[model samples]
Target: MSTIEAHDLAAGYGRVQILHDVSLRAAAGEVTCVFGPNGCGKSTLLKAMVGAIRPWSGTVTLDGEDITSLASHETLRRGVALMPQNGGIFPELTVIENLRMGGYILKSRKDLNERIEELLDEFPRLRERRGVNAGSLSGGEQMMVAIARALLLRPQFLLFDEPSAGLSPKLVGDVLKRAAALAERGVGVVMIEQNIREAMQVADRMYVLAAGRNRFEGTPADISDDRELMHLYLGIGKREEGTT
Candidate 1:
């Protein structure tokens, strides 16, 4: 099975460091969720993994092949793609135009058109709104476009940076479900999310970061069942007293 692994990764913006010895593993057909307090370096981790930012120390591998510090476009060519925060859509571009940009790596125009149609069929609402500007769509629709754009390359692994941000509760669930669906279709999904409750519903595994370091790594049940982790890191309410 295909996999992406980051080990002992440390990165920063200029002199301010963010990630510290953070490690994660995501495999094909599974959803790995990363979450934590603001400034915990969750976004930085994604950027490093996708090559949007260079890792100061450590290694990022695709199926045991070192791919650390490769350029973002190079990473995409290696079958890993990132859907940046807010879906990373161009507001003025029509939905179809945004999808076309996603396929910029493709050399054949016919293949690009076919892939667009396939994706449009996969996302029926996008077919209906193909000509409309992406900025005017609802948050959920924009997210769909972003995800579709990332899919244009037929990536083996997809990374999402806070895909559910600023979305309604219903839309949050919808987007997470989409992530889960992608995993079901054999695309590895690594997502950074703040919507804990919604994220837990779709995540196959979870990792928590604090102060740019790993605090917890386990399944959703492991987190919910651990009172200490819940109380200290997650801030989830209703913990039983004196439970270990």
Candidate 2:
């Protein structure tokens, strides 16, 4: 079964619709990328799916049950986690403290501690900086912390928005590698990315959004080879074969 599915979802900031009758799905153990120009409602869709914003219509289902109207915390408890475009970390807290906060919903302290240790091993950067204030970390390091915090919840589906937003090429590569690893470990990943080439490289399937609606859905090869798609979505005039 698909890990998360949205059917004809309509949502927006109070009175102005950003997503219009949108529908999409992310399957278990695969990455489904959502690519679009800025302001096409990619983040908004993530928010809606995670119940950060209530949809005006349609339904969002997780593992076959409708969860469209659940609260954000409620959704998190149901095993859906959203890591927003801006890495959401508590600036005042230490890295380990921030991770502890993500485990607020956990009922078992032992499980939480075990998960934190596992995440620390998986992300050594976080382990090394665990005692430092989260805000002191570099942008890429902060992003890594944000992702690790979300994983502490042991979410079944993860929504990532612009995971490579403001980092050096190397860090962007690192972040995408981590995301790919998450997919490999059986967590469903839905990513909204501005870096089309990197996002497509990690994605098993992709959806192209334009003007607040889905314009195309296909494999990376389908989009990479289509000059019109590159020109229109990414504003690149032309790209050589194997460029992305």
Candidate 3:
């Protein structure tokens, strides 16, 4: 069964409509990448799914239950987590402190501590900088901390928005690799990314959004080979040599 599903979703900011009739589904243990040009409503869709933005019309479901109108905290409590495109970490806090904040939703201190230890072991960079302020870390390191923080909640569905933004190629690879690992461990991952190539590489399935609508849905192989589709849906024309 699908872990997260959105049906005929229409969301926007103020009176400006961003997403129109956007429908998508994310399955357990799979990475579903949503790609589009800037302002195409990819992030808006993520926000709506996580209840950060309420949909004007449609329903969002998690594990077969309708959660369309739920509050953000309620959605998080139901095992859905959103890692927004920015501002995920508390800069003044140490890495461990930031992680502790993530576990605030948990009532049992022992369970929280155990989860933190497991996450630290999984993300050694966070472990090494456990006591350092998150603001002191590089962009990539901060991203890692944000991800580790989200994992502390033991979320079943993870929503990521532009996780590769403002990072070196190496760090981008690292972040996407971690996302792939999360999907492997049975967490349904829905990622909205500007880096189409890298996102497609890690995704099991992909959706192309154009003008706030789903233009295409397929695997990486289909996206890579279809130049016309890429140009129409993603605004990515044929790449010349030595171009991004």
Candidate 4:
């Protein structure tokens, strides 16, 4: 298992800087949730960590080994996976074929097949629709397939960009639960999420972001005790009793 972390990370697209001195950690078997409003650099941090975009300054590490300069392919080879916001399923491909495509990095076909079997068991609906084209599935089901595909690599570090977006309430809970479960199974889980209630539900530690800089960070217990903080940033908890 690996611990993925960023130290004083400052990243952006070209000259448009977004993240500012962001330091966070996601350890194996714990969900470290990044909470923020839109345009606050939550996704930027992930892109930097996964090598999709190079960090202008600071460091990203896997087990303390610097990976900031690695390309996305090289980062994936190191057992790190990022589930994109747009579900990355080939709509024309059957569920099984789509999953096989995800395991392209695997050297052995048998190992890939075995891992697919394990995933199908965990996502039984996938087994039920193994031969169906991914395009035919609902939004929530497609998300499930995308997550299953990411698991094909057996990544030690998994990062997700709002896995619950566009999902129905039930599916939102289901997806977040599975994300937390991955952490429980020894995969370091880092998730950027706007759904505060559900995000906090599965979070072991929470980092609140505002304007691309860290605003607050602590365990869920620490956060739960701060009603003012919750109300201010996340629009949760009670506000003034007689005020609108």
Candidate 5:
């Protein structure tokens, strides 16, 4: 199976360490959700995995090959793409134009156009607003644009950073369902999320990060049943006695 594994990762910006001994594994056809409080190095972990920032130690392996040092573009070429937080889209650009930028690495216009059409079919809503400026769309629509753009390259693994941020509860579910749908289509998905309840609904496996380290890694059921874990990391209040 195709997998992206980060083992014993320790990385951060200049003179400040944000992650320490963090590890995670995401496999093709599964959704692995990572959760934690703010500044727990959730985004930093994704950055390190995709080479947005180099790890001070440890390795990021793609199907067993060490790709820790590869540049972001190089990793993208190797079928791993990171959709950064906040739906990275050009406010002034139309939906189709933003999508075109996603395929900038493709050498042939025919291939690019074909890929764009394929994604449009997956996200039919995007087709309806292809000519409209992305910033003018609703939060959910903008997320669809960002996701479609990421899929233009047909990556084997897609990493999402807080994909549900700045959206209504309904849109959070919508965006997370899209992430789960991508996994169903055989793409490895690693997502950083704040919506614990919703994320558990779609995640095949879960990893909880705290203080820049691995705190918990288990199936959704495992997390829900653990009172301490639910209360401490997932922000769920513990069930009281006789509350069956």
Candidate 6:
């Protein structure tokens, strides 16, 4: 599977640049985690890559095809999906309602129903709560709905912005577990997550972004062996004795 590549991408809200020549590649069938502090433009990088924010310069290419100018809807049509930090689901919509809306791009009712049924089968909790309002579900369940909704689009590359932002510890782990499962299914997953330890646990490749620019990209082993590096980038100190 081909990867999504962002080359020298510089983008932000009007007249304010958040990303500074950022470049990274997320290959299909792997999970690439972007770690950084707040105000580091992690979400902006996601926005730029998905064409939600047009880049001041550079290109977002999927398998070598340029998509920097595509609108958000058009980008999704290209089989790239993004689940943002917030507003990914309709609070008032039921589980089935949100899942059905996910396949709205396809007009065939039969196909839509089939897809929805397939997803429902895969996510049994959603199936059980098919009638419950989304706002009524637990935080992890709501995130499950978001994942199910994104999968309905049949995307090859999925980008998640801060999947574990405000959840409890258990819920945060649950969310990352779901992301890992997506990678196992051969979806190219690029996620910006603040839960550094959990992110490292499931990542195939780790990219450390500081101040909106790419700092370090390496395997998990690289991170594990470099205590000082973790301290410098993530403010994490060495584990004390008997703290394993």
Q: Write the per-residue lDDT of candidate 5 for residues 49-146, one digit (tens) a residue.
A: 99999999999999999999999999999999999999798989999999999998899999999999998998899999999999999888998899
Q: List the global CA lDDT of all models.
A: 0.93, 0.89, 0.89, 0.89, 0.93, 0.88
Off by over 4 Å in 2: 237-244
For each candidate in turn, the TM-score is 0.96, 0.94, 0.93, 0.93, 0.96, 0.93
Worst 10 residues of 2 by lDDT: 235-244
Count of clashes, each model: 0, 0, 0, 1, 0, 0
Model 6 residue 138 lDDT score: 82
User: For each candidate, C-alpha RMSD in Å?
Assistant: 1.8, 2.0, 2.4, 2.1, 1.3, 1.9
Write down the TM-score for model 1: 0.96
Model 5, runs deviating above 4 Å: 239-242
Clashing pairs in 4: 29-183
Give the Cα RMSD of candidate 2. 2.0
Candidate 6 per-residue lDDT, tens place, 1-244, comes to: 7889999999888688889999999999899999888888889989888988799999999999999999988989999988888538898999999998888887799999999999999999999999999988888788889889989988999999887777899888888888898899899999998888888899999988888898888888897767766878887765542374
User: Per-residue lDDT tens digits of candidate 4, residues 31-99?
Assistant: 989988889999899988999989989999999999999998899999888888866789999999999
Report residue 105 deviation for candidate 4 (angstroms).
Answer: 1.1
RMSD of 4: 2.1
Q: Candidate 3 on 1-244: residue-level lDDT in tens?
A: 5589999899999899999999999997999999888889998999999999999999999878999999899999998999988647899999999999999989999999999999999989889999999999999889988998988888999999888889899988888998999999999999988778788789999998989998888899988678888776666666631274
> How accurate locally is residue 111 in candidate 4, as Cα lDDT from 0 to 100?
96
Candidate 4 residue 107 Cα shift, in angstroms, is 1.5
TM-score of 3: 0.93
Query: Candidate 3 local accuracy as lDDT?
Result: 0.89
Q: Candidate 1 regions off by >4 Å?
A: 239-244
Better of 3 and 5 by TM-score: 5
Q: Give the TM-score of candidate 5.
A: 0.96
Write one digit per residue (lDDT tens) for candidate 2, span 79-193: 8999987788898899999999999888899998899999999888899999999999989889989999989887899999888898888888888888899999899999987
Ranking by lDDT: 5, 1, 3, 4, 2, 6
- Please give the range of 10 consecutive residues that has the lowest summed lDDT in model 3: 235-244
> Which regions of candidate 6 are displaced past 4 Å?
238-244
